[model samples]
Target chain A: MDLRDPALYAPAGHGDAAVLLALRDPATGALAFPRTPYGIGASGTPAEAAEPVELSGRATLLVCVTVHQPLSPGMQVPLVVARLRLEEGLVIDGVLEGTEEPPPGSAMQAVLVMQGERRACRFRLVGGAA
Target chain B: MSGLASMRPVRVVGIGMHPYQFPSETPYVHLGLTALRGALADAGLAWPDITFAAIGTGAIGMAAGRVMLRHLGSTGLEVVQVENASASGSSAFRTACLMVASGQHEIALALGVDKFGSAQRAANKDGVPRLTPEAEIPAVKFAMMARAWRDRFGLTREDLARVAVKNHGNAARNPYAQFRKPRTLEQVLAANPVAGDLTSLQCTPRGDGAAAAIVASEEAIRRHGLDRRRAVRVLSSVSSSEHQVADEGWSLVEMVQRSGLAALEAAGLGMAEIDIIELHDAFTIEEIVYAEALGLCPLGEGAAQLRAGQWDIGGGRCAVNPSGGLLGMGHPIGPTGIGQVTEIVRQLRGEAEGRHHPGARTALAHMIGLGSVAVGHVLQRD
Candidate 1:
């Protein structure tokens, strides 16, 4: 899916569908997480004009830093941020999921999760199971 | 030889700065004039002696260079303004250096002025549109890089915290530094966290300030009968934009590597010959990353070098950020690059009282702007 297309963004009150689409691979019947998106071709843009690609295989995640921002009013902690290179060619940034405090460069799987009121892509430690 | 080396020698005859502080009702004129006058006085020259001027600022638009410089009596000399993100002031200094080195002008002034707190936030509608779903802010990008550095090099939180400790300590001695309080490793660790492992003390606080430098050709110095003993020669200056990196948020690493090497080559010196350094430590993690990129150590070995006390003042090794750095020195965007140059000039001139690096003969100043760009300058006392 072209990221710039309005369709890539979930319709109002359709957060669930957005989460599902973010995690499901259209090229295959199985589940997969969308990797970093970017534009290609003559009009290559960043996230919006980029091609749609999912993690073709397991990817390693490196959690960079976590800081609390005003999601509502007060501050929140453990807002884990990370970078992952997909089996394809895209390297993207996302939130890291889970509370176990995975070591840096830990193997992780991208998953759809809720960040405040919005659906966001995050990574979860694979526990050598991916 | 680099273009700068092939041209006539340019020397920094004077440097000045307004103490960095939180934005207040004060105008940019006061900030700019204060630094400019200080620079003129430091150089023992008058405003009429300036043949050209270059002003660097990130925000505060509308002919900013002319507006502030007019207060100093515009001799109708060329006044150019530059904005290169965090490297704004460094870029300005480079421009002034080139003008002098190329013999385009005999005497030039590079001034940087900024006041963000009193300014209005302009929408980012003009630049490249955000293409990623995630907001790739500096904190986010650096946080991720910190993680990658850790995974690749075994750098830990404690190792990073030491940078804040050292820089804050240096800032405590700098009257011009916005943050004058020294921090301990425990204090740094105890502060509120920002990005991955970065804390409030580890991140730079954007404040309001200005810095200025007067550069002159050898002919100008001779004609004006200026004190040659104190003039710091600009051996090399190099500016570069982000290159394709191994991954996103790693532009700083790549850009610094490219520009730093070019700068050293231009200066005709090795990294070991540099006595002191001032770099864009916008975050503590950057100090580690840049140290490695600047060839002070191998990739992933900065943490070890930090622990070995190699970068400390009077530690018999090159001092990093003796002027406190962006972290503790106060990063007022435009003034940051000039501020780094100010510190280097002072150190090389033996004017950095209380925080002097003993026997310092050569210094390097580095700054980076995210999205991203890097600027490097090598200066020598001889």
Candidate 2:
């Protein structure tokens, strides 16, 4: 994943579904979305993980990247995206399902960013005194 | 063969639903069988009379349709499973109705059931594409859409509040619904926001439940001496999903008008003929967005309709959700679509004592699920 792409711009209250056509370079642990197809709104959530996943055509990817608030919990619950690869594939991406948030504590603000109508927007994930 | 879209005058003989709560004692199969038993009893039919069965559910791994039926003594008849996002149950019912109406089957049963499994477990590697999130959680993304609607339509807090108030009143009378308690508009505005402007009541709660319905053709109904009064005719059934457009060039209201037009056409009726509607109200804002989409009201005019008590049960031109809907009732995934169908059946039959639509002869059940998909089924009492 590009560490500096507009997708990483996390703000609270902003989110949706987008089909990201990504090619993962195994050697570098890098992911890139050359094309994206987003729906009117998100039908489901998406996530990526520490595991290496090869992308096929335009794999569905979720990139909440959590907005940490002083009261909000941190990035403990990993997001998940499925049906990623178009053809040949390996190693699942994103966090496992049913992964709950970690214990509360001091929290930094977390902003979630996703592709929007014209461009990208940001919002903070409020609530939680972690 | 003309598919389900061509069939007509589909009648529901039996209907059943499991409560919207976790089943502590029943296995998934047992839950389904029990619902089947209830439906058979409701329809006054025997298991052997059922010529076909369709099951809608998301959690069951494979042959979900056949396994659940076998437990209930379902003969090795045609059994199909429907997996249309959250509308799985309703899709199954529609399939059965098509079969019976097309003369492919004499009697058919559609049962929808689901257990509370992982929210988003890995999906089947079907050829069909699944909606992958690009950069937001489901709640956040939906909230964004709500925000966009507010931004575009200039909806006010009262506009959203009307939906909560309307659904809560509907929910108050639903016995099997997850949340029967009522809420006022003031309480809704004061509730906490899950994302953007989405308060707690705006989103559907997750629960566990199952529901089933039996549909038969006019010939079969007459031959079997079924209760004609309780028979609910299937006017039309239509399903569509996101065509993968950037923003769906047309507005939500227009899309629903497209779907509503097809449904009304298939039923040989008009929107004005629809007495009560169980359209998708997964979120409070969705009611605002989708009511317009379904052509229940004009563009940017849903709040005014609610303000005028148009969507209320006893109000004029009732487009309703007395089962609390996904909002107050708790959406148990698969069962929701069937739950909506169940509500329509009850309303048409005048069996819903506390939450009846008051002499509704024609009713509609509309549901939208994952994939930006939508399904509409029209029903009328004999």
Candidate 3:
């Protein structure tokens, strides 16, 4: 897949327009620019047919990503996040929504939490305030 | 700690908070005064009627109590400012409660105001003192401490994941909470580690907020015609710090253990007698460490009890942070202490909806601050 193929990396769904948003349970350490382990390539990298996005995959995670809005205390999206999981639940630092930027200089991260196997719900972060 | 008023019992006549968020063009004094007004309104009393004011804030960032209260109009009463790190406001509130409960004053007000939490604070160029070194803010220093604890206990990252999961679940139910949503272990463990294993999520977010509680005496309660259902009295209050810089006996466990003993004894109660508990879970691991220190469970035995659903809202013995805590809930220094008390008050009255603690009559509000300071308050309906 080409790196700049617009179709593969279109902003997936809810919270796609903003650069930062609130992360609820999946805690991102920083309050500002809170990251996520649930987003996929939104605008840069094209998803391949043979390789599925997983959270437990043991390797560098470099992909284009986008969201509907910045993560915030009361925000959630629809099937917008694409999580890449590697083995052993070994979550690489660079793999989180690590800031919604493009790939190739994305500073690779190891991730063990991939999107679940349920459509829409399969790859979405469902959330509400406690 | 005894009086005729104490025998008759008392209740929270007022409650207040500076909205939990970054300050708008709104001045800190404005926020503080707003909460003062809110507390007075809640207590159904007039400002002229408030006999005493015990206010708290931090540093000299605007005279904390004095400047903030000036905005509330003129009051020719003695005003004392309390600056106890994060626990500043609650300590002051505790003072007011004790005064009213002891029949010292009929109508008293407790104010907690922090305008600098969300906004940056003025740096002390003369090299101001800090709980930790200049290079280590709270998250970094505590993360280092947590790593040390893990190494000592032989605990894995997976073991700590449960803390985030449990707290987030409880936070999801608190409306006044800064963060009120549930989280997953995977998500928590995966978040950015501010320092070592402490992820950004595990650290409390800084926000701006205030909480105020109006304390009234039984005579004042009768004078003001306040209701009983909303009445909750101070049971026990303890204020102490980590045994200062002791090489041989320095332990957070002992500091908390001694403080808990004093507070419980003052209230004539025990850990098992508490129906609801509100702890300072600023960091995910702090919950576990303090649970043991407070004698809720044996040291290192917290994880087992926590995993057993023993501390659920309706469980016989419940430890909670219905305001999302500092984890899922936001942390705005001064008001946080009063905020904790506010939650316990709600719990005692069975007023919580989304995260109700059924039939809760007694509750504990406890917090630990930098400099190893701790304050525990016991409140009961009887």
**Each prediction's TM-score versus the true structure:** 0.86, 0.74, 0.68
Better of 2 and 3 by DockQ: 2
Interface RMSD of each: 5.2, 12.1, 19.0
lDDT of 1 at B268: 92
Identify the runs in model 2 with alpha carbons over 4 angstroms from their true place: A1-33, A36-130, B1-8, B22-26, B119-136, B244-255
Candidate with top DockQ is: 1
Instruction: Choose the strongest candidate by lDDT.
Output: 1
Model 3 chain B scores worst on lDDT over the 10 consecutive residues at B126-135
lDDT tens digits, residue span B16-101, model 1: 99999977777988999999999999999999899899999988886998888777786889999998888899999999999999
> Tens-digit lDDT track for model 3 on B218-252?
78888778876687888677788876322223256
Judge candidate 3 against the unseen true structure and give its global Cα lDDT, from 0 to 1: 0.60
Comparing 1 and 2 by DockQ, which wins? 1
Ranking by TM-score: 1, 2, 3
Question: Which stretches of candidate 1 lie above 4 Å from their native place?
Answer: A1-59, A69-77, A97-120, A123-130, B1-3, B118-123, B126-135, B247-249
Model 2 TM-score, all chains together: 0.74
lDDT of each: 0.79, 0.64, 0.60
For model 1, the interface Cα RMSD in angstroms equals: 5.2
Model 1 per-residue lDDT at B127: 38
